[model samples]
Target: MPSGGDRHARDLIWGRKSDALRDLNRRRVLRAIMVSPGTQVNLAKFTNLSQATVSGIVQELQRENLVVVDGNDNERGKKVSLSNVRGVAIGVEVSYDTVTVAARRVDGDVDRVVVDWSGRGAEHGSQAWMRECVQLIGEVVRRTGLDETDIVAIGLGIPAAVDPRTSTISQVAWALDWERGMDPGARLQEHFPGVPVIMDNEANFAAYGEYLYGAGRGTETMLFVKSSTSVSAGLIIRGLIYRGRHGLASEIGHLVMDPLGVVCQCGNRGCLETAVGGARLVEQVRGAYVGYRVDLPNSLANIVERAKSGDLLCRRVLQDAGRNIGIALSRTCNLLNPEKVFIGGELGRAVELVIEPAIQTMRLHSLGGMFNYVAPMTVEASELGLKAGAQGALAYALTVHHIRPN
Candidate 1:
């Protein structure tokens, strides 16, 4: 019993609702396509839309020249891909002493460039590291044959916790002396005006990278432990990086193992990092070889190489580190119960020397249910190695729907 005006108003509201729903559906389809190009039927499967709906949306996108259909197969069988978009997504990872950048075009031509520089300063709050990061980004993008204006989005991974709510560096990065509430993303955005810069913990991006293209590909829940100069962890659950409140969820390095042991850079005593971190292991090796008049290993990579070459002292240090990491990971496994655990970074390179001991120790300390014969939790070395963080950042940047070529 509505009047004419009331009926018209109701119709208008319904029309707006319908339009909004359609737009949302379109975005979902586009996001799925961005992740992996596919045919209309495969797109329907990925986007969870009806075949008819995917076909219609794809046809509309094709008409707008946003996507192109290729292959000489039938319409449904033809592969669909993004048109030769003029933009590229860039991923940058800032570690304690390194900056790595990766760039890829949205047109899916497999053209990508990855570059890394070592010995960069470790102060996350200082301008030195930021300047180096910007330089590496430019270098990598240029190698990809893309100009600065071709950048659409950038994903930056830092060695500190980022507050998810504010997108700022949190006090948890005390080891690097990063100021609380410092916004690295904002600084990068200044250089790439109008470009969206996404930031997260480097370990999180590394986990995402492994989940997308490396060892964690088939896992429903995976944990990636980056044992570098400092140790950190990242968790990926069901294809999404799990960032708990304050972005400190998987800070396994800060776990207090020995309350009376050496003080950590974070001011905590005897955290896992103090025991198994790269610096600590290197210190142990150097301490043992003091005044030996032999060519001693200077870095973790050198130590790993020496261990592989059957250096007993280097092997022992890595073995002890593996055992210590296992002890901490056992506690983490009891809580998150991930399907797989991947060891990445300098330590991961010595898989046979490190991973075997770590696995044995983890098996001893972890919950028995995690080691069931039917589906035992497995641990492996990262297939992507040191480049995981940068690759992950690149893939993550491309996942941002609005950043797609307009």
Candidate 2:
């Protein structure tokens, strides 16, 4: 027969082990709801748990105020959603010519505002630009019917590499004029007191946003490239952003293509960006039509519009840029072997003109053995499009809001 102390010790250890398993099951149920709200039946299917087990876990979560049951008490009809999530989240993306702010309840639809700052002195490091961001965020909050006090977190996405250790933008991020150690997140926090702010590279957030809610959904691994005024890439491995040490992992735009070609802002020659960035494409078109054409595109958007309207020069330039971007992406694909590739930003809007050529070029450069070993990778335009960065920021804020300690 066991002694009293031995029995007590056995009971305590078993009880704790049981509690840990239950906690893990509860987290699985909660995550399924966060991905997309569904009835208990649907959650059971999504999580691969028995229906009875899912129901019990859902009930426990509801009692703890972690989930809300929408609709009637009917088990088949009621939908489960996250409840009492504390507060809403805001995502802001700042570009050279635009600022986009999106606000949403932690478990609801998003409301957004896009403000064009082209030629209006909205340059980075300018106080006016920061003020404009604050104003637009206020407008988005109003649209969402949420007060500033209800903002729990704000996510800022910039077109620059952020040092994870120091939280500073890199000097080579020429698109931004922000000084070292200048925290954009901190600046936004001043407007919404008590709310914490998170920041990351714009492409990184865009990739995360797409992974969670757009084309990259259901993919185990994916790479997202943004080819707009500049070129950048982001990697999503198993639904999480893979920011390498120092957050410089996916600086594909700076990858050198030619040692003696055009000089890049990063002090490199013939970087991928120099060959395929929107400005360079525009330059090529402008120079080609210098004396021949009466109508010239003033911007990359204009060129895309012209290409859609059957301008051969515009079409060729976009195709050429696509090919170059594809060649660069091929090397990355060989290394990471992503299941899907998503293209976003301005040029991504012209899928018919750009994506096909990109796919062709990538196939040409990729390893034949790799292609034979796995399923042929799919390439698609980003479903979030220009809103990817802002939406990603919002999703990131909501995801981290509950985990951060006060």
Candidate 3:
């Protein structure tokens, strides 16, 4: 009973839907190219679509001026880089007491890198900190000679767990005492409306940071331990960070070392952090120096310095902490069998004073032969150190590209 006009309207609706689907498929194809530039044929295999479909999308993307393809010239095996030219990408790492940002040029060969830093904490209740972030970003963009419209996407890493379902923070009490109900992603989205704000846990980003530019370069699987105000770890397997169920995979600080031990901020007793975190280390050492107005370094840096000067007190304390860390690491190693274990954050440089005891304890408790070849598993100090979080933010944003396999 349909009239000609009704049939025409239905045809129009179907045409719009077809275009939308094509655009979606084109975006996916482009993502694959951006992820690994030289990759080919694999995108179709992974997408479970026909190679012809992928190729057609690629052609459409290229025609739209969003992607460019270059030939391998004489090399038959060399695949083209499905280059994207829409905009640059930015990454930000907002921590308890600091904000770090990084940016990179998206399209061209003139690689530009910008680093932004501010001492604004989550406790600042969003406004002051958001202002600082805006100022920093604006300053960096101007410094790099790119306009606001030139930024395509932004990624952020935070310490608190972000609920995957709600895209809201799961619990902020343990990490940020003041801003318990803030949604950092929403705040970021407010600033850069229209751009997607991708958020992740700090350890996940740190693991990727190490894998991309630091101690974990070329590692098949890596364990990155962050020892600072708190102790946490991240896992990188096959060169990708493992985000556990609910995006809270690497919560290593809460692995109970002693049920009767000191309570953690997470309401757990005797967590690894309760024993080896910066606050506890400083507290333990402060009682030794009474009236001298002793000021401890943010990390155990001063302790490492004192230990290097042959101070048995500092050495003993650090060694004890190392033993505790190793005890936790041994269990983790048994479970994951990682090829490398990297130490970062404030306490990373103290590996020399700590690694021996950690190694001894790890050997004592682990299952046989799992870690025998883990020799030179290289318990390395982070070259990136405290900057890892910030630097990782930038590199992550720039590198996550969408592409099509040709």
Candidate 4:
């Protein structure tokens, strides 16, 4: 016999699913309008629910002034749609080194912004910084002329392992201690009250962003490599972001290179990041120029500039890092054999210097047969640039899956 606790848990799952379903239907209707502006979604496309249910919900939404009928189909005889009032969703991406805030108008048009936080995760406390992020979101909403009432949800991205089903972030990312067990989705509730929020790892969101609006467009499968202040990877299959059994699939930074290597932030040893992470690379460069009166820039852009200006030392440093990174990617590619590879983030800006060696080394170490199919694996820069994570966060909010607030 089932116990009361089990029954309650089942009820919880059903409730969450129902709520998610309703949220999804709303988004689908809104998405149809956003794409065509004047394009109308046939009322029948919303077959996930009963006709009565869909009609009632659509009526409620119409009553709220959130949606409007653009016009009825005259040729084939169907309903048409256009968002009467723009609904809004907020997206925040908190990386190891920066904070980016953007406001998306779900109804009429889309707009976004990216900001680099001077205070990093490992430096100031996460909670203190989280409050700052909340404040920034408010500013974005105001600047965009979006009313909080129209914001159905907020999506957030962090560079850490997050359990998608349970919304329970992994214990491995101790580097971001402040976010541990904080329930990122719940935190936004404290600020927005009735509004919902969704949070995920930056890499997963980036992969989705690229799939929807960036390099992965029209591709069946894609793998995104994020080379930044810290490093991570995301996998997309059939246009869906794949988070492993424990929501820890893309923890490539912790992929051990040498069993006896240095310790990783995840308590592992000799991770790929230890060899080519931006911070690690910077440290190595600093070590190389001990007495040359040379000082390194705090950001990767400066390094790229110097490398572009004929600085042999800078070029060598980036190339070596790329070589190490490529070695790591080569091993991963052997396992997945994805169709395309897109690189993004800070270090990614120097793909020319780093990518060639990375690919050369990756090819040099890989199996011969894998090379027979695709030519050079189509390595390219991120089309989304800095907004990749934010775009992904908003995508998460709009999707049916994920443990985000809504």
Candidate 5:
């Protein structure tokens, strides 16, 4: 119905649209590869693009030096990953007595270090811990063979509630002893310029880390509970951290278990923290052995060690703490319907002494129907251990856009 000129015009328009779509698909392929190394088949599934589309885009990206392919050229044989032209990302986790720093390219092993600063209090030590943290991060990056200028993104995980919108600490996290709304990332930025910083609660990052690279891998929904000096939980729903409004979504430690129980740092009484926090467990053990032949536990870590060495009192305390944790988690399981629960923190190292009680308690309180379903709720120890938060921070940094070197 149209002349050659009209047909030519239509052909040009269609060709341009097709080219744009192809470019978009190329980006999708690159993004998938950046997240993790995989074969073309995996990339197609991750990007929801055709194998042919991924193959074509991957070849183009390879030509442009934007991607690196591993192994042979067979479609399912070779693994494809990003070339890290944008530099590496760093993850920092600052606990009450320890700081861990990790650095890595987008898809490889990370260089990490853990430093104990127990006696050097952050608040009382004139914020010297911040300087130490910066130094440790630099050291880790150096181990990765990358200079300071190569840092593109930094993700920080602090032991406190962080306001996502403001990127500052929340008032409820009084244990930090810093200003209620102080931005730790902004403070760290002074040491590393031109790098975008992302921050979140340490437990949240740990949960994400467990989801991405640890015990919660492949789970549709997962919950991670940190039972240390303080009690906290992180929820992952559909592969993403579910930070509710105010960034205080999973503060299960503050759940009022007994209005008449001990007062928490948040000024709340009888919270789950009072019953199962690491400090509380240690205190119970010390009080019980004050005038006995058994030695007193100076810290929760010590108590866990004693439990593993056949200390009946220590084992009972850890088991009791686990049951209490399970009681709190049962309530969480009822509401969130998480598929798996991961136990982390200093106490999680005790494993059976703690987790067994928790699993039993969860069964006692959680809905029976959900457990009867095809996949009953599962409980496991954190695969990343103390490094979970730091690793999660690194993974988080990879997901964000950072300043590129010009």
Candidate 6:
């Protein structure tokens, strides 16, 4: 009973809705493929699409050359992957003393580069780190035989909390003096104009990386603790990084451990960082050798190496740090009850020295249900190690729909 004009308007609105829904489904399929290639059945499960819908989408994508289907078996059994010709995703991790870059192709190939900037005096600040980041990105991209124009999206991970609303650095700990409120994504965007930039905390990206491809894979809930010049934690819930309000969800370092302990950078007293952070552990070892004629270990890595080589003082300090970290993690576990916890960063290199004590302490303080024989929670070393952050950044960049293949 509608008039001709009314009918045309209704039809247009329905057409738009249909188109939008189709595009969204296409994006979901593409994202699942980016995570890892699989058959139509697996893709259907991953994307939560009906098998018929997945088949139709796969056929459409194949015709457009966006994805390739292989195997001489039935259509449902063939593996589907993103075309190797698709543009690359770039991920960069900027820590206090290091800059790591990774370039990942749509076909699952990756090239990476890492540089140590500790010797570059602190006076240079953000400028020096940004410059090094640019160079490292360029180097890694070239290693993949790709140019700047071939970059689809970039993920920048910094050792500071990034405000999710503004995509800018919100809070910096004492270890990194990066300017507060600076938009690292915008700065990186200037270098690679037209490429979208995704910025987040390095720990968040590291957690995502481990969840996708390392120790935390197959877990619905996981925690990644990054212990370096500073201490921070990232939580992965259902395959997504849980960045809570203002993007400071898992800031375990600021957790109060002592009421009247040394003041912390965030103006807190007796934070977990004060007790177990890399700087504090290094300080403890150096304090032990003070006024002695013998040379002392200077950096956390040095302390770790000394500990591995039978330095009782270094071992004891790290063990204490591990115990304190366990205490903090116990509280966290009691709340979130993650399936797994992965320890990464510089301290992770000495897993044998730290993980056992941490586990012992955590078992003591955490709820007994967490240690039940069946499906017990476990803590392990990060399989991806220092590369987790950068690789995670790369994987995350690919997940964002910055650009569609032409």
Best by TM-score: 6
Q: Candidate 5, residues 3-64: lDDT per residue as tens digits?
A: 11111111111123334677657655654554567889978876778888888888887886
Query: What Cα-based lDDT does every candidate model obtain?
Result: 0.79, 0.74, 0.65, 0.66, 0.74, 0.78
Local accuracy of candidate 1 as per-residue lDDT tens digits, 1-406: 1111111111111123334677767766765665557778777865668988988988987887778899888888888877634556688888887777877655554324455764674554458778887887788767666667777578999888998777788755566756888877888788887677888899999998888768787689999999988899899987778899889989999999999999998888999999988888888999988899378777899899999999999999999899989999999999999999999989999898889999999989998889865789999999989888887887776564333121
Ranking by lDDT: 1, 6, 5, 2, 4, 3
lDDT of 4 by residue, 269-316 (tens): 899887877777777767777787557555666777888888888899
lDDT of candidate model 6 versus the reference: 0.78
What's model 1's overall lDDT?
0.79
Deviation from native of the Cα of residue 63 in model 3, angstroms: 6.8
lDDT (tens digit, per residue) of candidate 2 on 301-342: 899999999999999999998888888888988898889999
Q: Model 6, 207-277: lDDT tens per residue?
A: 99898768787798999999987889899998778999899999998999998999998888999989987
Stretches of candidate 1 off by over 4 Å are 1-19, 38-53, 70-79, 109-113, 400-406
Listed per candidate, the RMSD to the true structure in angstroms reads 8.6, 9.4, 8.8, 8.1, 9.2, 8.3
- Number of clashes in every candidate structure? 0, 0, 9, 5, 0, 0
TM-score of 5: 0.85
Worst 10 residues of 1 by lDDT: 1-10
Q: Given candidate 5, what's the lDDT at residue 27? A: 50
C-alpha TM-scores of all predictions: 0.87, 0.81, 0.76, 0.80, 0.85, 0.88
Residue 168 displacement (Å), model 4: 1.6
TM-score-based ranking, best first?
Answer: 6, 1, 5, 2, 4, 3
Q: lDDT score, residue 104, model 4?
A: 62
Q: Residue 207 error for model 4, in Å?
A: 0.9
The TM-score of candidate 6 is: 0.88
